[model samples]
Target: MLYRYGSLIHRRARLVLVIAVLLIAGAAVAGAGVFGRLQGGGFDDPGSESSKAQRLIDERFGGRANLVLLAHATGGSVDAPDAAAAGRDLAAALQREPGVRDVVSYWSAGVPDLRSADGADAIVLAHVDGDATQRRERAGQLIERYAADGPALHVRAGGETAVNLDVNGQVARSLAIAEAIAVPLTLLLLILVFGSVVSALLPLAIGGIAIAGTFAELTALGAVTDVSVFAINLTTALGLGLGIDYALLMVTRFREELGEDRPVAEALATTVATAGRTILFAAGTVATALTALLVFPLYFLRSFAYAGIGVVVIAALGALVVAPALLAVLGRRVNAWPVGRRRASRSAGTAFWARLAGAVMRRPALAALPVVLGLLVVASPLRHVAFGTPDEGVLRPGSAGRQVADRLATGFPSNQNASVDIVLTGPVDRDRLAAYAQQLSTLDDAALVTSSAGTFGHGTRAGEGNPALSRPTGERLTVASRLTAKSDAAQRLVRSIRSAPAPAEAYVGGVDAALIDTTHAIGARLPLGIAIVVLATFVLLFLFTGSVIQPLRALVLNVLGLSAIMGALVWIFQDGHLASWLRFTPRPMDTAMTVLMFVIVFGLSMDYEVFIIGRIAELHGQGMPTDEAVRTGLGRTGRIVSAAAALLAVSFFAFGTGTVSFLQMFGIGCGLAIVVDATLIRGVLVPAILRGLGRLNWYSPAPLRRLHATVALREA
Candidate 1:
């Protein structure tokens, strides 16, 4: 099948090139519309209990207050004449805005909790009326208008909407910065490895097609679904990296075949059947791993699955179809303008790999133990790893939204700005409601609780009922807690509130409640997601190797390498090592980011796994002895793997310079994983395990062996 495709492409190389150019140009133009269609936040599980509560609240009440305007007095207390006038004006201005509602402030309501302890800062709470995307848009406008220092009062926006805007903006900036740094460095390295300026340019062409194509896909997907803007980052990095990886494999094989003086068509066909087949298997493994993300409820994670699977398929197609068409057209000009003797350097590097493989295979178990132990030690920190949702804290301290959050956390006592909003539906008995509200207010972390019955503090009725808390169908209560939002303590508060006896159909929906539900939703679905990844990988790899044992070995080594990387992330991001240098807060690992890292790293590990094992399997198929095949295969593929992994690492590690902590962890972890796997795991552990397995490395059950014989594409 591959040979026929390559031959057809070769015969029609010029027509193929012309057609591909037109299609990709169209894709580029369509892809330019993608940004306008993308959204800001998708981290919440919309069907969880918190979501249900939110739905009920939006239906029963006006809407929950999700935007906070922090009004600060530059010279005096908020109650002073000038500051009071400014606070009232701020509230009135917000109330008059088109999409702003439920406006309440310290000056108008005299809510003690809305005033800071020092009396210099007061908060105006309002509900931005719209869907998540629209709310962010409305909030952005309000922030620009009001969230600035003034002669009388200073105001800043903070809350769900503001945080979403900041995160999205940071991601946009991170992508630009990462591309700005990675692209030039990658080109320089590609030139050094390929030993010619012409050869280096080919990968960029492949990458451009992959990225442009995936961007078009995202644009179409975004038009109908909730796609996160963050997915754009994955699309850019993976598209370019995969482009280089597939190009290096294909070009190297083509060059080798051409050296045998084969006709251009014959050489191209051989390259497709060989390197092209490997690219197919590699793309399958990557897509299979990413498909598991669809099981998660969060669109934030699912968006990556869309972008990742699209990039893999598009990049692989470019590598197979468009790339071959280009190569066929280029013919011997593909090797034009050489900078140095590329073949001689590869030959020298191959010899070094052969010696290293021989030394390891000679004493497989003995040489493997120390390396295995060292990796286990690197993975040890995962034992105590913690996880949290990304918030304003993920942004740099200087970010506007983050600064507002910082002030809210430290300056305020207890306010609805950071509270568990519990709505009671169906029927509300006033006396029972008062008792329930009192029960919540008496909890250790509950600083105050207010309902239609009255406001309570420490189990005592401290104020009259607020009309906003009452409704015809039921009553709503706001629990102003002492625990920080999205914290372990805050999550505990949610559990306590849920566990507490209720007077009616109580629905808890707030930042803390949402966090608890999001965590639970992910945990409940994780096992199935993991099962899909493991089972699918095992089957695909078995198909590739025709051996059950080889897949098992690959899976083990990949997991080990990924564990070491995850543990390193825990030590650095979660445990606060290099926090100052990375310029991120030391907190729990972002659960979504951790899951993303694992899947992506796992997929990429399979990428290198396919490259090395494809060569080893081909040599073995030619009746080479096990020891000879292991040494020769490592010798042949080592330089390619090293160079490819280095280029890919450059693409990822540039994100380490980002101000967003989660992206920093993601970039650094993935880049480090690639480097470590290409060197230690691929170079040392693989050959040692192969030597230990001997002929068993290719062993399969009789049924599978017969099946393999029927459909094996082992060589070009």
Candidate 2:
């Protein structure tokens, strides 16, 4: 099938080139709007209990106060006449803004909690009305309008919405920086690998086409659904990385076939029949692994899945269709300006890779044990893994939102925005609500609890007769206790509130509650996500290799490699070992980012696995002994796999240069996993394990064998 497609493309090369040009042009135009269309945040699960509570609060209490403007007095306490007057004016102006609501400040409400501990700063808190995206937009404008240094006071915008805006901006800058570094470095490495400037440029061209198509597709997807701005980083990295990978394989095979003195069309056909088939299988595996993220409810995870699948499909098409047409046109000139002697067709049982494979085959168990143990030792830090949601701290240290968060954490008694909201439905009276508030105040971690009846601290009423604590409709009352997001104390406080008796049906909603709920939602669906990935991978690999065992082995090896990568992320990011070097604050790794890395790394590991094993399987089918097949296959494909993995690793590492911790985690984690998989696992463990299994590596139950043959890809 690929041979026929390649033949048709070769025969119609000019037409294909013209169509490619047209598609690229259209894609570039359509994709230009992608950044503007994407959303800034998607960390919450809409159907979770916390979400329901948040909705009720918004409906009854005018939404959660998710925006904060901190006003710092220039010389004295905020009560100084000049600072007080400026703060009051700023608060009043904010209240008049179209989307701002419930603006509260020390000057407006005389609430002590709104004042900083030192009395030199005060907070104006308000809710930005709209969905997440709209709220971020409004917050951006408000920051521009209000965040400034006046003679009396200095004001800075900080809150969930503001943090999201900062995060989105940093990600954009990081993407630009990553591309600027990666593209040229990738070109240099490609030239070194292919030893021809002409050959080196093809992959970048294919990558550009794939990236253009991916952005255009993402823009279109954003029109119908929520797509996280974070997906853009993945699209850029994978589109270029995988595009180069597939194109390198095809170009290398074409060059080899041409080296054998085959006619251009025939060489192209043979190249497509072999390397093209591998690309299809590799793309399928990658897409399947990413598609597993669809089981997750968060748009953050789902967005990557969408972007990943789109890039894989587009990259594959570019390599299969556009790359071949380019290759057909280039012909012998593909190797023009070669830097070194061009590699001839690989000979069996002779090359350095073959010799290494033989040495490992001679001592399979001895060779395998240390690599496995070494990887396990590296992965040991996962035992201490801690999960947390990303916040303003995920941004760089001096970023506006992060600076605000740092100040708030240090100056305020507690984070009001991170407060736990206790919603009481079917409440009877003030006395009952007071009793509930008293119970909440008794918890060791609860700083204060506010209700309609009074404000309680340490189980005592600190104040009374606060009407603003209750909804005007009078059927609901809100009890708020300040807490930190994702801290153990906050999590414990949430549990206490839920288990404590209340005057009415109680629901807990706040940053802490939302964090707990989001974690649970991901955990609940995790098994299913793993199942989908595993089952899909098994089926796909069985069809590709006609052996169930090889697929199972692939999964095992991938898990080992992924374990080390996850452990390294925890050790470096979470444990703060590399915090100074990486320039990120020490915090628990984001749960969603961790899961994303797992699925993506698994898919990419399978990508290299298929390329190498498929070659070995083909050699075995041609009657080579198992050892000879392994050696010959590794000899033939080892350079290509290493080159592809290096290119991909460089792309991911470039993204690691990003200031955001989320991007850094992805960039470093994926890059390390690719390099480790390509060298340690693929080079050492795979050959050793297969050599130990010998002919059994190809064994399957008779019934399954027949089933596999029916689905297995056949060479022309």
Global CA lDDT computed for model 2:
0.88
RMSD of each: 1.4, 2.0
Candidate models: Cα lDDT each: 0.88, 0.88
Model 1 bad stretches (over 4 Å): 415-417
Please give, for residues 574-644, the per-residue lDDT of candidate 2 as tens digits: 99898898898889989999999999999999999988998999899898999999998998788888889
Candidate 2 clash pair list? none
In terms of TM-score, the best-performing candidate is 1
lDDT tens string, model 1, 1-716? 88888899899999988989999999999999887788877788989888888888887888887788888898778888999998999999999999888999999999888899899899998889887678878888989998988888988888778888888778888889999999999999888888877778888789888999999999999989999888898898899999889988988888788889999999999999989989999999999999999999899999999999999999999999888988898888887788888777768878988999999999988889999999999999999998777788898888878887888888888645458888888778888888998898888788888888899999899898787888888888888875677877778878888999998878888878887888888899999988999998998888898999988999899889988898998999889989888888898888888888889999999999999998999899899998899899888888889999999999999999887888888889989999999999999999999999988999999999999888866665
Candidate 1 residue pairs in clash (backbone atoms < 3 Å): none
